[model samples]
Target: MTDIRLFQGPELLDHAVALHSVYVDAFCAPPWNEDAEQAIEFLGSLRVAVRRPGFTAALAFGGREVVGFATAWTTLAPFPTDRCYPRAAAGLGPERTVDWLCGAREIDELAVRPQAHGTGLAADLLEAVAEDAPDGRSWLLTSLRSPRAMSFYRGQGWTQATHPSPDGEGIVVFLGPRHPAGALAAQPL
Candidate 1:
């Protein structure tokens, strides 16, 4: 079994950097690397998610080195709304425009080191996050173009939602029992 720990303070920042590095190696997506500005943005988002309430960051270590990390939250704002609030709430009254956000769990981000990519580390990281969540529907968004990524969710039995990516690209949402094997129902160890 992989050892996991709850991240605190700058610990999240450290993982965010590791996550940034691995993301570049795995995807080479422009925004993930070769773009200093984009890398900064990506790291900023990761740092934010790790610090949010009900949000937990899990890092896996191979004895002495931090090989991978995943971060998620117990609540999420609905799409369009979730995506827009950070932009639209610039001037609206907090009691008004912000009221729409309530009672939603969000798996904001998850990334595994390229060196540890094929070791089932990603699934284990997600499983740990799910294990900590209270019984309830949860959701995550993954690139639909990446069949491997999509398959990973399908294996976990995530249901497809109607929401499509703003870019018109496929993006599927998943909400299901934390565990299909019934292991998730067991008492916390």
Candidate 2:
């Protein structure tokens, strides 16, 4: 059986190395094709992310070895413009972006070692980070290139709020099942 632990604030840095290992194992191949530099960059970003308001993380351990992990934090109002935030904002438009995502819990990362693919560890980790989301509102952005990931989130009842054009080469946003905007997500833009 796998043991999962939830950590909040900078204290999560205690397992940084192990989490980095899991990240590389989960993302450094095939569809993701990430590299050592990217993993190191993630570690640096994680240091900053842990300091964000309402930051939370979950680590899954299999006999002391980290097999999966997830990170999340409360999104603040005024909506950020960094990274993929613009993509999400552009997709949802300013009003819906503020209403649905500004104060929601945003999942930043969810990675499970390849060996743990079918063990339900990912779902557990996701739930652990999101369990205490404010007002049960949570959201995430994922790449449209990863069909398996899209399918997994959809199976977990996350509603895709963005649909990419036919080329399908961009990111998509998802609202948690309990989010108030989930029903409104299906409405025409």
Candidate 3:
């Protein structure tokens, strides 16, 4: 049996190491190829991210070990000026991007251990982290290279957005329910 735990704000700080370990284990494989040093840097970034408004996280445990996890927070109003967000915002355009994402929850991370794959843990963690979004609005970005990941998101009712990630990172954007993008995507061609 898998046990799942939900964490918010300050409570997330306590599980920082465990979360990082899961992230490193999950992303360091195949398409991501992130190194331990990069994972540590991500941990540093996570420390600040959890402090943001509407931060939330969920973790799945197999016995005493972390097997999967997810994290998210509300997107910024003007959008972020740093990293790939600006490029992503540019691709989505100002109005739709802000309207759908500004106050909407953005799932920042989701990972599952190799041994725990195909056990439905990822979906459970995703649901837990996104369950509290106001009006059911939520979104996320993932690599275009990960077919399995993209397929899983699609299978879970996530809609792909027209915007592409900046920096040629092969990033693909997805919007959950109640997002304007979903309506746009559903319209007849």
Candidate 4:
């Protein structure tokens, strides 16, 4: 059996750190060559505001351990991600316009411990996040080079944005809704 917990207040801080560690472990350096230690610190620092509205951490428990987790938050008219500028630029380059500024849900991290994979833990965490999204739409950007991540997202019914993100290597944007009308399509993965 499995259970999920949505954190708030001081508990939000501890769980946020745990989720960051999981993210750094799962995402790795990949095509960007991110340093693992740095990634952990960078993402962990985001806990400051995640204590507020929209941000949340969902942990999937397998007996005494946390087997899977997710970290995400909502974006409104002004955009909360600007605060993540320094961190985002580390891997994603310049802000180049916060496309989800008008309002959208952004998933920063989702991870499941290797020992707990294939138990529907990740999907369970995602479902909980999706349910509480600012709205039903969650938008995220990923390295088009990571087929594993992209394929998993696609399997969950996330569609690539028609418009490729504005970047040198071109990160693919996956919108959880109907592909955003005419946003631009991605090359086949």
Q: lDDT per prediction?
A: 0.57, 0.91, 0.82, 0.61
Sorted by lDDT (best first), the order is: 2, 3, 4, 1
Sort by TM-score, best first.
Answer: 2, 3, 4, 1
Where is model 4 poorest over a 10-residue stretch in terms of lDDT? 88-97
Q: Model 4: per-residue lDDT, tens digit, 1-189?
A: 788988644576655555665666555655445677766665555655476557776888777566778766765544445544333334323343254323566676677876666767877787777665554667666665666677787788786653344354546656675324214434445
For each candidate, what TM-score against the reference?
0.68, 0.97, 0.91, 0.71
Cα displacement (angstroms), candidate 1, residue 159, comes to 2.2
lDDT of 3 by residue, 1-189 (tens): 999998888777788788888888898878889888899988888888879989988888889888888889988788888866865676578887788788899999999998888888888888898877878889998877787898899888888785454344567678885565687753213
Off by over 4 Å in 4: 29-33, 79-101, 162-168, 177-189
User: What stretches of model 2 exceed 4 Å from their correct place?
Assistant: 187-189
- In model 1, the Cα lDDT at residue 45 comes to 75
**Model 1, span 1-189: residue lDDT tens:** 467776644566755556777556555652233465655677777766666767777788777666766677755343235553333333223442223223435565666666776788887877666665555545566655666776677687654432344463445545445523232222213
Candidate 1, superposed: residue stretches over 4 Å from native? 8-10, 29-36, 76-102, 163-168, 179-189
Worst 10 residues of 1 by lDDT: 179-188
Greater-TM-score candidate between 2 and 4: 2
Candidate 3 deviant stretches above 4 angstroms: 163-168, 178-180, 186-189
Models, CA RMSD each:
8.2, 1.4, 2.5, 5.0
